[model samples]
Target: MAGFPAPQTPRGFGSGKTGMRTRTTRFGRTVVALMLREMASRYGRSPGGYVWAVMEPLGMILLLSIGFSLVMRSPALGNSFLLFYATGFLPFNLYQRLANTVGTSLPFSRNLLTYPAVSWFDAISARFVLNTMTQLLVSYVLMVGILVVIDSPVVLSFGPILFAFACAALLGLGVGLVNAVLFGLVPVWQPIYRILNRPLFLASGIILIYESMPPLAQDILWWNPLLHITGRAHEGFFAMYTPQYVVNAYPIGWGLVLTALGLLLLRRHHARILQNS
Candidate 1:
């Protein structure tokens, strides 16, 4: 009896911190597996894969730079049209693509969701993390390329830029969660959402600066969270230009409110929605 070893406790069934760690580990593994699967299906099967991701955005930036160069001597904020448009377009694109991916996360992973190990949160998280990383990488590359190629004397303020990116990502996630429920249940909301989303680029200060817009336009667009995001981005990239109308609380509020509503709805109706699907 003196030499007998102490009995060992079970791994995952333990109380308090052990159980919490076990749950967190399981969720992390599930999310990672889903992310791997998504990368394989979405990019590995395609011909060009991730290359297309960079090309598409780069092409848009180039076209915008070329078109605007012909019309005007310089861009609104900076002499380099590429930098101005990249700052606006990249963050907006990140939000747009993230929202689309997260919106379809449940439907896309429907079969997998049936398994006990997988969950709706895991599915959404996989899409959100993978896509967000991809977009951020693309943005970094394109922005660096523009800065190097143009060799412009630009000073970047990371505070507003990081804030802008955070707002965009959270806003995308928030809207996507709500859309996920609506798209899964209503079925007709998908097309309607797309129709409504088309004008965001034009209205979001991507092609046009906010201060240049007429007062009426500014007043109307002030409510758009994307506009605030873009304004923050411009403030980061263009040191001289600061937008007085950009309110940090407005976009943050939209993100938090929409996310809360979406999570609440999902918690309440996810089972029925999944079953119906």
Candidate 2:
């Protein structure tokens, strides 16, 4: 016993804390590796790479600004159509893109799932983290550019703006988790989900303010959690506007419920999904 290394604890038979730490480190590395792989595969191959990410939204905002400026004297909330649409479009776009990516996490990483180290949650998290950070950076750059170029008289309220981002991310993650399960389990669900989602752009207060809508439309659109998110976003950008229709609990409640449901379903069915894949 003097010279021999104290009976080396067999790998994975170590103390509880050591085991936990090993697992944690492993999970973190797995997630990071997956993130890097995605970045290379998704954006690295494209021409102009990440520039397209910012330009796509910027182009859309510019087109909207030019077209709207022709028909209307000013935006509904502010003098600059660029700022108004950017505020509404950016957060909504973040949710849409994030949800779409998160929804496909399982199938996208199906091949890797065969490995013991790669779990379904890890796949979802990698996509979520990568896309979320990319979108946030794009938003920041565009927002700063708009403020610099447009000279819009606007007050920046970080509280509501951050709240909007949080809600968008939560909703995206929650709905995405559910979609990932459904999309993987039921192939037909993808098309139907797309059809249902198409109306969200118009309905989410991106093109129309909540107050300006008819009473009947207001009553119905109020149920859309995204409408509340856009309203909250507008509140942060426009000092004069305060949307009473936005209920803080509505979006948060939907996000929490859907996230819980999605996680439960994924846990129950992930093995079957992997097998089928």
Candidate 3:
């Protein structure tokens, strides 16, 4: 028998591309893989998994619309109440889901973090991507359903809706990253997060516009960036909708600032935290 050639080691095996590809490619691949993993784990096997994501929000909208229209006798939101609610509620849900999921991401992925290829950002990105996609799908389904049910004149304006969702995602991701880092630092942060996030549902412009409020109240609500996003989203869906609310540059600015800070913190401390855990 011919002597077997020495086993050839794979190129880049010890050169940082063995398990992980090159940095840029690896980062993209990791993010995408993590996103897929999350989708599969969370919503793949069950038939209702993905459908429920859309249905849950739609149900909330229907219930709220009926309650407001029949029981509360609230003024009509717009020609298409379901559409209006979809525009506002979907983005708000995205923000809330992203923030909540990301807040617990690090701890949630502690096991995966043992693998060198898996980074903290990968975990956070996975959750964010999953939540973002789910919310967008839900929004689209609700929008179409509303048009069919209510027969409202739906304008397919891409600009405002795109901007609104972008802003919402950015804001949510920034807050989530910060919260995740903090939670990784302090395990007790979960209870505090729950308390803080619960109040946000009411404060965020889910059911009403900020402009409809009194001056003082409007001034106060103006500080919330979600209000601006909801207003802009509604503007996209309904012709009559306009954002009269004053939103300072702070919330948007804070999103950028926090994201940067969170990334820096994650880069520096994430590995250590993983090792400690």
lDDT of 3 at 123: 89
Model 2's TM-score against the true structure: 0.93
Local accuracy of candidate 3 as per-residue lDDT tens digits, 1-277: 3687878878767876645556878888888887777778778877789888877887888877777666544433575556666778888888888888877777777887778998888888888887888787777777777788887567666777887888888888898888877777776786888887787767777776776677887777777788888877877876766665535355578679878988888888887656544
- Over the stretch 112-207, how does candidate 2's per-residue lDDT look in tens digits? 988999999899999999999999999999999999998756788998999999999999999999998888789899999999999999999988
lDDT of 2: 0.91
- The segments of candidate 1 whose C-alpha lies over 4 angstroms from its true place after superposition are 1-14, 45-47
Worst 10 residues of 1 by lDDT: 10-19
Cand. 1 Cα-lDDT? 0.92
Q: TM-scores, in order shown?
A: 0.93, 0.93, 0.85
Q: 216-263 in candidate 1: lDDT tens per residue?
A: 999899999999999999999999999898999999999999889888
Cα lDDT for residue 184, candidate 2: 76
